[model samples]
Target: MGEGIGFEQPETVENKGIADELGRVLESVPPKENYPPDRELQRSILDQLPENLVEELHAHLIVVEGGKEAESSAEESKLRGELFERLATAQYGRAEAGTQDPRLAEELSQELVQLMHDPRRFGLEEQIGGIRNPDLAFFKINDQGKVEIEAAGEVKLGLLTPRAAHQIGGGFREGTRKMVEVVNRMEKPEDSGLLAVAQSRTRGGYLSASENLKVKLIVPADRNPEKVKSLVNRGIFPREDYVRLLELLKNKDEVEILKSAFSRQEVAAMADHLIGKIRERYK
Candidate 1:
Protein backbone atom coordinates (compact mmCIF):
# COMPACT_ATOMS: atom_id res chain seq x y z
CA MET A 1 0.00 0.00 0.00
CA GLY A 2 1.13 3.59 -0.56
CA GLU A 3 2.38 5.57 2.39
CA GLY A 4 -0.47 8.06 2.17
CA ILE A 5 -2.96 5.20 2.30
CA GLY A 6 -1.55 4.40 5.73
CA PHE A 7 -2.14 8.00 6.97
CA GLU A 8 1.11 9.55 5.86
CA GLN A 9 1.26 12.90 4.14
CA PRO A 10 -2.10 13.73 5.69
CA GLU A 11 -2.02 17.52 5.46
CA THR A 12 -2.75 17.29 1.78
CA VAL A 13 -5.33 14.53 2.12
CA GLU A 14 -8.43 15.70 0.33
CA ASN A 15 -11.61 15.24 2.35
CA LYS A 16 -13.44 14.55 -0.87
CA GLY A 17 -14.73 10.98 -1.22
CA ILE A 18 -15.43 9.50 2.20
CA ALA A 19 -18.50 11.56 3.07
CA ASP A 20 -20.90 8.76 2.15
CA GLU A 21 -19.11 6.15 4.23
CA LEU A 22 -18.90 8.47 7.21
CA GLY A 23 -22.67 8.85 7.41
CA ARG A 24 -23.13 5.08 7.43
CA VAL A 25 -20.45 3.94 9.91
CA LEU A 26 -21.25 6.92 12.05
CA GLU A 27 -24.97 6.18 11.91
CA SER A 28 -24.62 3.68 14.71
CA VAL A 29 -23.03 6.31 16.89
CA PRO A 30 -25.56 7.21 19.59
CA PRO A 31 -26.93 10.67 20.12
CA LYS A 32 -24.73 13.16 21.93
CA GLU A 33 -24.93 13.31 25.70
CA ASN A 34 -24.93 16.26 28.04
CA TYR A 35 -21.99 14.15 29.10
CA PRO A 36 -20.14 11.43 27.23
CA PRO A 37 -23.14 9.18 26.70
CA ASP A 38 -22.25 5.69 27.69
CA ARG A 39 -20.50 4.28 24.63
CA GLU A 40 -22.19 0.93 25.17
CA LEU A 41 -22.27 0.10 21.49
CA GLN A 42 -18.67 1.01 20.90
CA ARG A 43 -17.59 -0.87 23.99
CA SER A 44 -19.63 -3.91 23.08
CA ILE A 45 -18.26 -3.95 19.58
CA LEU A 46 -14.73 -3.56 20.87
CA ASP A 47 -15.27 -6.35 23.37
CA GLN A 48 -16.87 -8.75 20.90
CA LEU A 49 -14.22 -8.48 18.23
CA PRO A 50 -12.04 -11.57 18.38
CA GLU A 51 -8.54 -11.31 19.74
CA ASN A 52 -7.22 -12.15 16.29
CA LEU A 53 -8.84 -9.03 14.94
CA VAL A 54 -6.89 -6.95 17.43
CA GLU A 55 -3.76 -8.86 16.49
CA GLU A 56 -4.32 -8.22 12.82
CA LEU A 57 -4.98 -4.60 13.69
CA HIS A 58 -1.81 -4.52 15.71
CA ALA A 59 0.29 -6.15 13.00
CA HIS A 60 -0.97 -3.90 10.25
CA LEU A 61 -0.27 -0.92 12.42
CA ILE A 62 3.28 -2.10 12.93
CA VAL A 63 4.00 -2.98 9.29
CA VAL A 64 2.48 0.24 8.02
CA GLU A 65 4.28 2.45 10.53
CA GLY A 66 7.56 0.67 9.91
CA GLY A 67 7.07 1.05 6.17
CA LYS A 68 6.48 4.79 6.50
CA GLU A 69 10.07 5.55 7.38
CA ALA A 70 13.21 5.17 5.28
CA GLU A 71 15.62 6.95 7.57
CA SER A 72 19.25 6.08 8.19
CA SER A 73 20.04 3.39 10.72
CA ALA A 74 20.80 5.98 13.37
CA GLU A 75 17.49 7.75 12.88
CA GLU A 76 15.63 4.47 12.74
CA SER A 77 17.11 3.49 16.09
CA LYS A 78 16.02 6.78 17.56
CA LEU A 79 12.49 6.27 16.24
CA ARG A 80 12.44 2.79 17.76
CA GLY A 81 13.27 4.20 21.17
CA GLU A 82 10.48 6.74 20.89
CA LEU A 83 7.99 4.07 19.89
CA PHE A 84 9.18 1.85 22.70
CA GLU A 85 8.58 4.50 25.30
CA ARG A 86 5.02 5.01 24.12
CA LEU A 87 4.35 1.28 24.34
CA ALA A 88 5.80 0.84 27.81
CA THR A 89 3.43 3.42 29.23
CA ALA A 90 0.55 1.85 31.17
CA GLN A 91 -2.32 4.22 30.59
CA TYR A 92 -2.34 5.34 26.96
CA GLY A 93 -2.32 1.94 25.24
CA ARG A 94 -4.70 -0.90 24.55
CA ALA A 95 -4.22 -4.58 25.38
CA GLU A 96 -2.37 -6.64 22.80
CA ALA A 97 -4.11 -9.55 21.13
CA GLY A 98 -4.00 -12.66 23.33
CA THR A 99 -2.10 -10.79 26.01
CA GLN A 100 -2.53 -7.91 28.41
CA ASP A 101 0.86 -6.47 27.48
CA PRO A 102 0.88 -3.86 24.75
CA ARG A 103 2.71 -3.97 21.47
CA LEU A 104 4.40 -0.60 21.49
CA ALA A 105 5.03 -0.50 17.77
CA GLU A 106 1.40 -1.34 17.00
CA GLU A 107 -0.01 1.20 19.45
CA LEU A 108 2.27 3.82 17.96
CA SER A 109 0.90 3.01 14.55
CA GLN A 110 -2.69 3.70 15.59
CA GLU A 111 -1.77 6.88 17.47
CA LEU A 112 0.22 8.05 14.48
CA VAL A 113 -2.95 7.96 12.41
CA GLN A 114 -4.90 10.03 14.95
CA LEU A 115 -2.10 12.58 15.00
CA MET A 116 -2.23 12.91 11.19
CA HIS A 117 -5.94 13.74 11.20
CA ASP A 118 -5.40 17.08 12.87
CA PRO A 119 -9.03 17.98 13.53
CA ARG A 120 -7.77 18.78 17.03
CA ARG A 121 -5.00 21.12 15.78
CA PHE A 122 -2.09 20.48 18.11
CA GLY A 123 1.05 20.50 15.96
CA LEU A 124 2.71 17.71 17.92
CA GLU A 125 4.96 15.88 15.46
CA GLU A 126 5.60 18.15 12.53
CA GLN A 127 9.18 19.32 12.19
CA ILE A 128 12.72 17.94 11.85
CA GLY A 129 11.98 14.28 11.07
CA GLY A 130 12.04 13.25 7.40
CA ILE A 131 10.14 10.42 5.75
CA ARG A 132 11.15 6.81 5.99
CA ASN A 133 8.69 3.92 6.35
CA PRO A 134 6.19 6.00 8.34
CA ASP A 135 2.97 4.36 9.61
CA LEU A 136 0.81 7.51 9.51
CA ALA A 137 2.61 10.41 7.98
CA PHE A 138 0.45 13.41 7.18
CA PHE A 139 1.66 15.26 4.15
CA LYS A 140 0.25 17.66 1.60
CA ILE A 141 1.53 19.75 -1.27
CA ASN A 142 1.86 23.23 0.06
CA ASP A 143 1.28 26.45 -1.92
CA GLN A 144 4.74 25.71 -3.26
CA GLY A 145 5.53 22.36 -4.92
CA LYS A 146 7.26 21.09 -1.81
CA VAL A 147 5.59 18.57 0.48
CA GLU A 148 5.03 19.15 4.22
CA ILE A 149 4.64 16.04 6.32
CA GLU A 150 3.35 15.49 9.85
CA ALA A 151 3.77 11.97 11.17
CA ALA A 152 1.85 10.88 14.27
CA GLY A 153 1.68 7.80 16.50
CA GLU A 154 0.13 6.60 19.80
CA VAL A 155 1.42 4.68 22.79
CA LYS A 156 -0.35 3.40 25.86
CA LEU A 157 -0.24 6.25 28.34
CA GLY A 158 2.29 6.26 31.17
CA LEU A 159 4.64 3.73 29.59
CA LEU A 160 7.94 5.51 29.79
CA THR A 161 10.65 5.14 32.41
CA PRO A 162 10.57 8.29 34.51
CA ARG A 163 13.62 9.69 32.77
CA ALA A 164 12.79 8.42 29.25
CA ALA A 165 9.51 10.21 28.51
CA HIS A 166 11.08 13.46 29.58
CA GLN A 167 14.04 12.75 27.32
CA ILE A 168 11.78 11.93 24.37
CA GLY A 169 9.47 14.83 25.12
CA GLY A 170 12.64 16.89 25.28
CA GLY A 171 13.72 15.58 21.87
CA PHE A 172 10.38 16.93 20.77
CA ARG A 173 11.27 19.99 22.81
CA GLU A 174 14.61 20.55 21.04
CA GLY A 175 15.08 18.35 18.00
CA THR A 176 18.59 17.87 16.61
CA ARG A 177 21.09 19.64 18.74
CA LYS A 178 23.56 16.89 17.80
CA MET A 179 22.58 16.83 14.11
CA VAL A 180 23.68 20.43 13.67
CA GLU A 181 27.23 19.45 14.44
CA VAL A 182 27.34 16.58 11.95
CA VAL A 183 25.64 17.98 8.82
CA ASN A 184 26.80 21.56 8.44
CA ARG A 185 29.45 21.61 5.71
CA MET A 186 27.57 22.82 2.61
CA GLU A 187 24.71 24.90 4.04
CA LYS A 188 25.72 28.41 5.04
CA PRO A 189 25.33 29.18 8.73
CA GLU A 190 22.24 31.29 8.05
CA ASP A 191 20.63 28.54 5.97
CA SER A 192 21.26 26.17 8.84
CA GLY A 193 19.64 28.69 11.15
CA LEU A 194 16.59 28.71 8.88
CA LEU A 195 15.83 25.11 9.83
CA ALA A 196 15.64 25.87 13.53
CA VAL A 197 12.16 25.73 15.16
CA ALA A 198 11.12 26.32 18.76
CA GLN A 199 14.71 27.24 19.52
CA SER A 200 13.67 30.46 21.18
CA ARG A 201 11.55 28.55 23.69
CA THR A 202 14.52 26.32 24.34
CA ARG A 203 17.17 29.03 24.23
CA GLY A 204 15.29 31.35 26.53
CA GLY A 205 15.51 30.41 30.15
CA TYR A 206 12.28 28.80 31.34
CA LEU A 207 10.26 31.54 32.98
CA SER A 208 8.41 30.64 36.18
CA ALA A 209 5.07 30.85 34.39
CA SER A 210 6.15 28.71 31.46
CA GLU A 211 7.24 26.03 33.89
CA ASN A 212 4.29 26.51 36.21
CA LEU A 213 1.38 26.88 33.85
CA LYS A 214 -0.64 23.77 34.58
CA VAL A 215 -1.82 22.15 31.38
CA LYS A 216 -5.40 20.99 31.57
CA LEU A 217 -5.06 17.45 30.26
CA ILE A 218 -8.33 15.86 29.27
CA VAL A 219 -9.33 12.83 31.32
CA PRO A 220 -8.74 9.79 29.17
CA ALA A 221 -11.65 7.55 28.27
CA ASP A 222 -11.56 4.84 30.88
CA ARG A 223 -13.34 1.51 31.38
CA ASN A 224 -14.61 2.09 34.90
CA PRO A 225 -16.68 5.21 35.52
CA GLU A 226 -16.98 5.41 39.31
CA LYS A 227 -13.37 4.56 39.91
CA VAL A 228 -12.32 6.95 37.20
CA LYS A 229 -14.55 9.72 38.54
CA SER A 230 -13.08 9.26 41.99
CA LEU A 231 -9.70 9.82 40.45
CA VAL A 232 -11.03 12.79 38.50
CA ASN A 233 -12.43 14.27 41.69
CA ARG A 234 -8.95 14.05 43.08
CA GLY A 235 -7.83 15.96 39.99
CA ILE A 236 -6.49 13.29 37.63
CA PHE A 237 -7.31 15.84 35.01
CA PRO A 238 -8.36 19.32 36.03
CA ARG A 239 -12.07 18.49 36.10
CA GLU A 240 -13.20 22.08 35.79
CA ASP A 241 -11.61 22.42 32.36
CA TYR A 242 -13.07 19.15 31.08
CA VAL A 243 -15.19 19.20 27.94
CA ARG A 244 -16.59 16.15 26.25
CA LEU A 245 -17.17 15.63 22.53
CA LEU A 246 -20.42 13.75 23.12
CA GLU A 247 -22.03 16.93 24.42
CA LEU A 248 -21.48 18.52 21.02
CA LEU A 249 -23.35 15.74 19.28
CA LYS A 250 -26.57 17.38 20.40
CA ASN A 251 -25.90 20.37 18.17
CA LYS A 252 -25.93 19.57 14.45
CA ASP A 253 -23.50 22.20 13.31
CA GLU A 254 -21.02 22.00 16.17
CA VAL A 255 -18.34 23.91 14.33
CA GLU A 256 -19.67 27.21 15.64
CA ILE A 257 -20.43 25.71 19.03
CA LEU A 258 -17.47 23.47 19.67
CA LYS A 259 -14.72 25.17 17.63
CA SER A 260 -12.45 22.11 17.55
CA ALA A 261 -12.37 18.49 18.69
CA PHE A 262 -10.37 19.43 21.74
CA SER A 263 -12.61 22.28 22.86
CA ARG A 264 -12.60 22.49 26.65
CA GLN A 265 -16.32 22.94 27.17
CA GLU A 266 -17.41 20.02 25.03
CA VAL A 267 -14.78 17.64 26.30
CA ALA A 268 -15.63 18.29 29.94
CA ALA A 269 -19.30 17.65 29.31
CA MET A 270 -18.52 14.42 27.55
CA ALA A 271 -16.33 13.37 30.43
CA ASP A 272 -19.23 13.82 32.80
CA HIS A 273 -21.46 11.53 30.78
CA LEU A 274 -18.76 8.94 30.34
CA ILE A 275 -18.08 8.93 34.05
CA GLY A 276 -21.69 7.90 34.57
CA LYS A 277 -21.53 4.62 32.68
CA ILE A 278 -18.06 3.16 32.08
CA ARG A 279 -18.83 -0.16 33.82
CA GLU A 280 -22.40 -1.33 33.35
CA ARG A 281 -22.25 -4.03 36.01
CA TYR A 282 -20.93 -1.62 38.60
CA LYS A 283 -23.38 1.08 37.67
Candidate 2:
Protein backbone atom coordinates (compact mmCIF):
# COMPACT_ATOMS: atom_id res chain seq x y z
CA MET A 1 0.00 0.00 0.00
CA GLY A 2 1.14 3.55 -0.74
CA GLU A 3 0.98 6.68 1.40
CA GLY A 4 -2.21 8.81 1.42
CA ILE A 5 -4.46 5.75 1.07
CA GLY A 6 -5.18 6.28 4.77
CA PHE A 7 -4.96 2.70 6.05
CA GLU A 8 -4.18 2.53 9.78
CA GLN A 9 -1.77 0.00 11.30
CA PRO A 10 -2.91 -2.47 13.94
CA GLU A 11 -1.23 -2.39 17.36
CA THR A 12 -0.39 -5.01 19.99
CA VAL A 13 -3.14 -5.50 22.54
CA GLU A 14 -3.79 -7.42 25.76
CA ASN A 15 -7.11 -9.16 26.05
CA LYS A 16 -7.11 -10.37 29.69
CA GLY A 17 -8.12 -13.91 28.86
CA ILE A 18 -5.37 -14.20 26.28
CA ALA A 19 -2.79 -13.12 28.85
CA ASP A 20 -3.89 -15.62 31.49
CA GLU A 21 -3.66 -18.38 28.93
CA LEU A 22 -0.07 -17.49 28.13
CA GLY A 23 0.87 -17.42 31.83
CA ARG A 24 -0.21 -21.03 32.19
CA VAL A 25 2.07 -22.00 29.32
CA LEU A 26 5.14 -19.89 30.18
CA GLU A 27 6.03 -18.89 33.70
CA SER A 28 8.10 -16.62 35.93
CA VAL A 29 8.72 -13.39 34.06
CA PRO A 30 10.45 -10.55 35.94
CA PRO A 31 9.67 -6.83 36.03
CA LYS A 32 11.48 -3.86 34.49
CA GLU A 33 13.18 -1.17 36.62
CA ASN A 34 14.16 1.57 34.22
CA TYR A 35 11.52 2.49 31.68
CA PRO A 36 13.21 4.17 28.75
CA PRO A 37 11.98 5.39 25.38
CA ASP A 38 13.54 3.68 22.42
CA ARG A 39 12.44 6.51 20.19
CA GLU A 40 14.77 5.50 17.42
CA LEU A 41 13.65 1.86 17.37
CA GLN A 42 10.03 2.88 17.84
CA ARG A 43 10.26 5.16 14.85
CA SER A 44 11.73 2.42 12.73
CA ILE A 45 9.03 -0.03 13.80
CA LEU A 46 6.36 2.62 13.32
CA ASP A 47 7.59 3.12 9.80
CA GLN A 48 7.01 -0.57 9.22
CA LEU A 49 3.59 -0.52 10.88
CA PRO A 50 0.69 0.34 8.64
CA GLU A 51 -0.45 3.95 8.99
CA ASN A 52 -3.67 3.03 10.78
CA LEU A 53 -1.65 1.27 13.44
CA VAL A 54 0.00 4.59 14.26
CA GLU A 55 -2.70 5.23 16.83
CA GLU A 56 -1.85 1.96 18.58
CA LEU A 57 1.85 2.78 18.87
CA HIS A 58 1.20 6.26 20.23
CA ALA A 59 -1.37 4.86 22.62
CA HIS A 60 1.68 3.28 24.22
CA LEU A 61 3.13 5.46 26.99
CA ILE A 62 6.57 4.99 25.43
CA VAL A 63 5.61 5.80 21.87
CA VAL A 64 4.31 9.29 21.22
CA GLU A 65 1.81 8.00 18.67
CA GLY A 66 1.09 11.71 18.29
CA GLY A 67 2.88 11.41 14.99
CA LYS A 68 6.38 12.81 14.55
CA GLU A 69 6.24 15.52 17.20
CA ALA A 70 4.95 13.43 20.12
CA GLU A 71 7.59 10.95 19.10
CA SER A 72 10.16 13.67 19.75
CA SER A 73 9.01 14.14 23.35
CA ALA A 74 11.92 12.71 25.33
CA GLU A 75 9.92 12.71 28.61
CA GLU A 76 7.16 10.21 29.42
CA SER A 77 8.01 8.65 26.06
CA LYS A 78 10.89 6.67 27.58
CA LEU A 79 8.88 5.80 30.68
CA ARG A 80 6.54 3.67 28.61
CA GLY A 81 8.79 2.41 25.81
CA GLU A 82 9.57 -0.84 27.59
CA LEU A 83 5.90 -1.69 27.95
CA PHE A 84 5.19 -1.12 24.27
CA GLU A 85 7.97 -3.28 22.87
CA ARG A 86 6.89 -6.08 25.21
CA LEU A 87 3.44 -5.88 23.70
CA ALA A 88 4.25 -5.95 20.01
CA THR A 89 6.18 -7.82 17.30
CA ALA A 90 5.88 -9.43 13.85
CA GLN A 91 4.68 -13.10 13.60
CA TYR A 92 4.40 -15.71 10.89
CA GLY A 93 1.00 -17.32 10.19
CA ARG A 94 0.59 -21.06 9.59
CA ALA A 95 -1.35 -22.57 6.73
CA GLU A 96 -4.01 -25.22 7.46
CA ALA A 97 -3.36 -28.90 6.75
CA GLY A 98 -7.07 -29.92 6.67
CA THR A 99 -6.75 -33.36 8.24
CA GLN A 100 -5.49 -35.47 11.13
CA ASP A 101 -2.39 -36.38 9.21
CA PRO A 102 0.32 -37.37 11.68
CA ARG A 103 3.02 -35.35 9.99
CA LEU A 104 0.99 -32.17 9.95
CA ALA A 105 -0.22 -32.73 13.49
CA GLU A 106 3.33 -33.21 14.73
CA GLU A 107 4.41 -29.99 13.07
CA LEU A 108 1.65 -27.96 14.71
CA SER A 109 2.44 -29.48 18.09
CA GLN A 110 6.06 -28.42 17.76
CA GLU A 111 4.99 -24.92 16.78
CA LEU A 112 2.90 -24.71 19.92
CA VAL A 113 5.91 -25.68 22.01
CA GLN A 114 8.00 -22.96 20.39
CA LEU A 115 5.22 -20.45 20.85
CA MET A 116 5.16 -21.28 24.54
CA HIS A 117 8.86 -20.60 25.02
CA ASP A 118 9.13 -17.57 22.76
CA PRO A 119 8.75 -14.15 24.34
CA ARG A 120 7.99 -12.73 20.94
CA ARG A 121 6.05 -14.87 18.50
CA PHE A 122 5.00 -13.54 15.11
CA GLY A 123 3.10 -14.83 12.12
CA LEU A 124 3.72 -13.55 8.65
CA GLU A 125 1.06 -11.22 7.36
CA GLU A 126 -1.50 -12.84 5.16
CA GLN A 127 -0.80 -12.94 1.41
CA ILE A 128 -0.59 -9.14 1.63
CA GLY A 129 2.85 -9.45 3.33
CA GLY A 130 3.59 -6.57 5.73
CA ILE A 131 0.11 -5.93 7.08
CA ARG A 132 -0.21 -8.17 10.19
CA ASN A 133 -3.06 -9.32 12.38
CA PRO A 134 -3.16 -10.28 16.09
CA ASP A 135 -2.45 -13.96 15.51
CA LEU A 136 1.16 -13.69 16.70
CA ALA A 137 0.73 -12.02 20.10
CA PHE A 138 0.93 -14.01 23.35
CA PHE A 139 0.85 -13.37 27.09
CA LYS A 140 4.25 -13.66 28.79
CA ILE A 141 6.15 -12.18 31.74
CA ASN A 142 7.66 -8.75 31.10
CA ASP A 143 10.39 -6.97 32.99
CA GLN A 144 7.70 -5.22 35.02
CA GLY A 145 6.13 -8.60 35.84
CA LYS A 146 2.68 -7.34 34.89
CA VAL A 147 0.39 -9.39 32.66
CA GLU A 148 2.25 -9.19 29.33
CA ILE A 149 1.90 -10.95 25.98
CA GLU A 150 -1.46 -9.89 24.62
CA ALA A 151 -3.56 -11.11 21.70
CA ALA A 152 -2.63 -14.78 21.58
CA GLY A 153 -1.99 -16.03 18.08
CA GLU A 154 -4.87 -18.06 16.61
CA VAL A 155 -4.76 -19.26 13.01
CA LYS A 156 -6.80 -21.62 10.86
CA LEU A 157 -4.05 -24.14 10.12
CA GLY A 158 -5.07 -25.60 6.81
CA LEU A 159 -4.05 -25.76 3.20
CA LEU A 160 -6.49 -23.61 1.28
CA THR A 161 -8.68 -25.73 -0.92
CA PRO A 162 -9.55 -24.58 -4.41
CA ARG A 163 -13.08 -23.95 -3.20
CA ALA A 164 -12.03 -22.17 -0.03
CA ALA A 165 -9.44 -20.03 -1.76
CA HIS A 166 -12.08 -19.06 -4.30
CA GLN A 167 -14.36 -18.01 -1.48
CA ILE A 168 -11.52 -16.10 0.13
CA GLY A 169 -10.83 -14.32 -3.16
CA GLY A 170 -14.44 -13.30 -3.57
CA GLY A 171 -14.68 -11.72 -0.13
CA PHE A 172 -11.18 -11.45 1.29
CA ARG A 173 -12.09 -8.59 3.58
CA GLU A 174 -15.30 -10.25 4.66
CA GLY A 175 -13.62 -13.53 5.43
CA THR A 176 -10.90 -11.81 7.41
CA ARG A 177 -13.50 -9.83 9.30
CA LYS A 178 -15.16 -13.06 10.33
CA MET A 179 -11.87 -14.64 11.31
CA VAL A 180 -11.15 -11.63 13.49
CA GLU A 181 -14.51 -12.09 15.17
CA VAL A 182 -13.57 -15.68 16.09
CA VAL A 183 -10.15 -14.69 17.37
CA ASN A 184 -11.67 -11.95 19.50
CA ARG A 185 -13.92 -14.47 21.19
CA MET A 186 -11.03 -16.81 21.97
CA GLU A 187 -9.61 -16.28 25.47
CA LYS A 188 -8.17 -19.60 26.69
CA PRO A 189 -5.24 -19.50 24.21
CA GLU A 190 -3.90 -23.06 24.85
CA ASP A 191 -2.73 -23.69 21.32
CA SER A 192 -6.44 -23.74 20.49
CA GLY A 193 -6.03 -27.45 19.55
CA LEU A 194 -5.82 -26.80 15.80
CA LEU A 195 -9.24 -25.36 15.23
CA ALA A 196 -9.91 -25.56 11.51
CA VAL A 197 -8.95 -21.96 10.93
CA ALA A 198 -10.58 -21.98 7.54
CA GLN A 199 -14.39 -22.00 7.29
CA SER A 200 -16.88 -21.64 4.42
CA ARG A 201 -20.56 -21.13 3.66
CA THR A 202 -22.59 -23.34 1.34
CA ARG A 203 -26.17 -22.16 1.67
CA GLY A 204 -27.33 -19.64 -0.89
CA GLY A 205 -30.50 -17.52 -1.09
CA TYR A 206 -31.85 -15.68 1.93
CA LEU A 207 -28.48 -16.35 3.52
CA SER A 208 -26.38 -13.65 5.08
CA ALA A 209 -23.26 -15.47 6.27
CA SER A 210 -24.52 -16.52 9.66
CA GLU A 211 -21.87 -17.25 12.27
CA ASN A 212 -23.17 -20.79 11.79
CA LEU A 213 -21.44 -20.72 8.42
CA LYS A 214 -18.38 -22.88 8.98
CA VAL A 215 -16.49 -25.74 7.35
CA LYS A 216 -14.93 -28.91 8.74
CA LEU A 217 -11.24 -28.15 9.07
CA ILE A 218 -8.24 -30.24 10.09
CA VAL A 219 -7.41 -30.87 13.70
CA PRO A 220 -3.83 -31.51 14.81
CA ALA A 221 -2.82 -34.93 16.01
CA ASP A 222 0.54 -36.70 16.18
CA ARG A 223 -0.08 -37.95 12.65
CA ASN A 224 -1.42 -35.95 9.71
CA PRO A 225 -1.38 -38.04 6.54
CA GLU A 226 -1.18 -36.20 3.27
CA LYS A 227 -4.66 -36.23 1.79
CA VAL A 228 -3.34 -35.25 -1.62
CA LYS A 229 -0.08 -37.17 -1.56
CA SER A 230 -1.24 -39.72 -4.11
CA LEU A 231 -2.41 -37.05 -6.51
CA VAL A 232 0.91 -35.21 -6.56
CA ASN A 233 3.59 -37.62 -5.39
CA ARG A 234 6.74 -36.15 -6.94
CA GLY A 235 7.00 -32.34 -6.83
CA ILE A 236 3.45 -31.62 -7.87
CA PHE A 237 0.61 -29.70 -6.09
CA PRO A 238 2.03 -31.19 -2.90
CA ARG A 239 4.88 -28.83 -3.58
CA GLU A 240 7.99 -29.56 -1.57
CA ASP A 241 7.81 -26.08 -0.06
CA TYR A 242 4.74 -26.87 2.03
CA VAL A 243 6.26 -30.13 3.19
CA ARG A 244 9.50 -28.37 3.94
CA LEU A 245 7.62 -25.71 5.87
CA LEU A 246 6.23 -28.47 8.09
CA GLU A 247 9.56 -30.24 8.52
CA LEU A 248 11.64 -27.14 9.17
CA LEU A 249 9.51 -26.22 12.15
CA LYS A 250 10.38 -29.59 13.66
CA ASN A 251 14.16 -29.45 13.22
CA LYS A 252 16.30 -26.57 14.46
CA ASP A 253 19.22 -27.11 12.09
CA GLU A 254 17.18 -26.89 8.87
CA VAL A 255 15.83 -23.46 9.80
CA GLU A 256 17.81 -20.35 10.63
CA ILE A 257 16.42 -17.14 12.07
CA LEU A 258 18.19 -14.19 10.56
CA LYS A 259 20.58 -12.85 13.20
CA SER A 260 19.83 -9.45 11.76
CA ALA A 261 16.21 -9.88 12.95
CA PHE A 262 13.25 -8.80 10.83
CA SER A 263 13.28 -5.99 8.28
CA ARG A 264 11.43 -5.61 4.99
CA GLN A 265 14.61 -5.93 3.00
CA GLU A 266 15.79 -8.90 5.04
CA VAL A 267 12.50 -10.71 4.64
CA ALA A 268 12.71 -10.27 0.87
CA ALA A 269 16.21 -11.63 0.94
CA MET A 270 15.15 -14.59 3.06
CA ALA A 271 12.45 -15.42 0.55
CA ASP A 272 15.02 -15.41 -2.23
CA HIS A 273 17.43 -17.46 -0.19
CA LEU A 274 14.71 -20.02 0.58
CA ILE A 275 13.88 -20.23 -3.12
CA GLY A 276 17.48 -20.94 -4.02
CA LYS A 277 17.82 -23.49 -1.25
CA ILE A 278 14.60 -25.31 -2.23
CA ARG A 279 16.01 -27.17 -5.21
CA GLU A 280 18.93 -28.55 -3.25
CA ARG A 281 17.00 -29.32 -0.05
CA TYR A 282 13.66 -30.58 -1.36
CA LYS A 283 14.61 -32.22 -4.67
Best by TM-score: 1
Model 1 C-alpha lDDT per residue in residues 126-171, reported as the tens digit of each score: 3323321222222222222222222222221222232322222333
For residues 1-283, write the lDDT of model 2, one tens digit per residue: 5777654434323233333332332222232233333334433433333332323333443233443333233423332232232323322222223322323323432343243333144232232232222223222222232221212332222233333323322232244344444433444323444222111111110112232222222211111324333211233324554464444323333212211122222222322332333333433
The window of 10 residues in a row where model 2 has the poorest summed lDDT is 198-207
Local accuracy by lDDT, each model? 0.28, 0.30
Best by lDDT: 2
Deviating ranges (above 4 Å) for candidate 2: 1-133, 140-149, 152-261
Clashes of 1: 42
Candidate 1 C-alpha error for residue 10, in Å? 16
Q: Supply the global lDDT for candidate 2.
A: 0.30
